[model samples]
Target chain A: MRQHLKKAGIILFWLLVWQLVSLLVHNSVMLVGPVETIKCLCRLVVTADFWLSIWYTFWRIGLGFLCASLLGILLAFAGAKKLILGEFLSPFFAALKSVPVASFVVLLLIWFGSKNLSFFTSLIVVLPILYGSTREGLANNDKKLLEMAQVFRIPFGAKLHYILLPGLSPFWKSAFSLALGMCWKAGVAAEVIGQPLQSIGNRLYQAKIYLETGDLLAWTVVIILLSFGVEKAFARLLRLLPGEEKKEPDSMKEKGDVA
Target chain B: MTIQVDHVSKFFDGQPVLDNFCMELSDGNSYLLTGPSGSGKTTLLRILLGLTRPDSGRVRLLGDYKYSAVHAGVVFQEDRLCEPFSAVENVAMVSKKLSPRIAREALEKLLPADALDKPVRELSGGMRRRVAIVRALCVPSDVLLFDEPFTGLDRENRKKAIDLILAEKGSVPLLITGHSDEDLGFCHPIDIRTGVPLQMG
Candidate 1:
């Protein structure tokens, strides 16, 4: 309860600061307070364009993220198994990490047009992160467990499911969270640059062009809420796996079990 | 089944770990591979389990077409139970013949009843050691390899572990590396450093 109160207080203090700054500026077109942003969000939520825009951006970005994460994991597994593959892919992954997102957005816009720009942009932004993390996770896997499996002759599939999957869960969870946030940010940025039809990015561009600061703030809040919601849902799903749960021994509760 | 290691040798960083070591053991006999700390007992076992190639020797497992790893169940020098899994799950995951109930019964003999359901990471070292032993013993294999299997067990639990191993490993050849006379019980002891057999009477 104390933690909850502290968090609420921090949010309230930030809101008060924003309200005071907006009042001092005395220009609603240039800056909007939290109340005005929330009102704009309430008004926007009832409109059909709002839902369609969200759906468009969500599916395109979500699809790209899913494809990149799966492909990254597969490539990382292959690379970890074969040293030559890892060596060949290292330079490519490094280049992806270092190159600017705007350059990719401009180049992709020229090639693929606006319809699929965000999807490809999201994939380009997320792949290197997931790939690097998956390879690192595989490299850090417990050698002793692997040797035990080999000595016992545990089948390949069982080793993957029982040992490797569980061992990689922590890395996978962290990578997914990081990649999900980056996917949204890059996807929207691409949509804004490309001006795709019925996208949150298109909405943001329209609001900026009209100088509606309240709408821009409201849409930004929506993006943050969507990102937070997806991250929390995905993390909760991961925690549901049997290997991830931290259950106390039932016998320990009954007394005199360990002693 | 027969395990024949014909003149195996291993070297690391210009140091001799196993120099022309040779041994042979067959079905229905237990052998204790006794050696000093750096005498390559683990190297020999690794060679037998097909984990490492003998620098200049051949290891042949006769009587089955399965690979050496498939034929041998091992309690590794370290307790290598999957940290997130319960002890019963660890045993049952590796064992082809033992169901969870049977694995639990086998484990209860060596591990406390409460520790059986807890993940191996939460269990103490001694408990984890018994989980490793139970996993190796319950698994279906033609032979067993135990490398210092009783390292963390107390006197009582060590005797219980040995008894459990004996009860479960029926008619299969056993190769173990240990210095304790009690752990060797009825198995023929061989000093791996000298490559000579020693009688433990």
Candidate 2:
């Protein structure tokens, strides 16, 4: 409870600072305080268009992330098994990581239309991260455990359940955390450029053109909340995967044990 | 089946770990392989399991073997139980022939009932060792290989583990490595360095 209060107090301090800065500027066009941004958000929430815009971008980007994750894991498994495939794809994934998100967004807009820009953009952005993390995870799997499995002739399904998933959990968790945030940023940027109809990015673009600082800040706040919410939800989903849960040692409870 | 270690030699970094070691491990017998540290006890076990290949020698499974490959239940020097899994899951995961119920029964013979449900990581060292022993016994294999399986085990638990292994490893060749032959005198004692049976004085 104290920790939560401390966090709220910190946020309130920053809001006070933001309000003072906006009052000094005295131009609502250039700067809007937290109060104005919240008021704008309240007004936007009542409109049907606001919910529709959220749904449009949410499904597209969410689908892109899910598909990329599946593909990345499958490809990483194949890559790990075949050295030649890993060697072959190393440069391709590296290039994908290096290329700027804007360049891909522009090129995607030309090849495809604005309709599926966020989907493709987010997919491309998240694929390499997932692939790299999974590859590293596979590489770091305990060799001794694998050898034990091999000697015992444990089936592939059992090995995957007992060894592979648990080994990959840590890497996947960190990678998902990173890729979730990256996908949202890239997906929204693509939407803004493509000006997709009935999308959050389209609203953000309109807000910019009309110089509605309050609407812009409000939409930005919405994106932040959405990104945070999705990340938390995805993390909770990841916990369902089979692995070890870390717990504090209860010395008193551990006594009188026999083996 | 008899596992013949025919002059098996393994070297690391141009140094001889096992120089022309030879031994015959026949079926329905247990061996206590005694040696000091760095005496290639583990190397010999690895060679039998085909995890490591000898530099110049070969291992042969003589007699009628149902399978082309050697299937072994091994307890490694380290307690290689999946740390996140409970003792029952660890044992059950080794073979489809063994289920969670079967594993729980086997583990109950050596471990406390309360410890069976907890993750192996949370268990004490001796408890983890016992879990490894149970996992090895639960797996279906033609041979049983244990390297330092008694580490961290007290005399009472050690006796329980030994009894469980002997009961479970029926008609299979069992090779266990340890620091001494005390309390393991029932098995034929062999010094790994000499690769021959020790003189029982």
Tens digit of lDDT per residue, candidate 1, span A141-257?
A: 889888888767787776886788888889989988999999999999999999999999999999999999999999999999999999999888777654776434455665665
Q: Deviation in angstroms for B20 in model 2?
A: 1.4
Q: After superposing candidate 1, which stretches have Cα over 4 Å from the reference?
A: A247-259, B63-70, B95-98, B197-201
Clash list (residue pairs), candidate 1: none
DockQ of each: 0.64, 0.75
lDDT of 1 at A143: 90
Give candidate 2 misplaced runs (Cα > 4 Å). Answer: A246-259, B66-68, B196-201
- Please list all clashing residue pairs in model 2, or write none if there are none: none
Q: What is the fnat score of candidate 2?
A: 0.93
Highest lDDT: give the candidate number: 2
User: Among all windows of ten consecutive residues in candidate 2 chain B, which has the lowest summed lDDT?
Assistant: B192-201
Interface RMSD of each: 1.3, 1.1
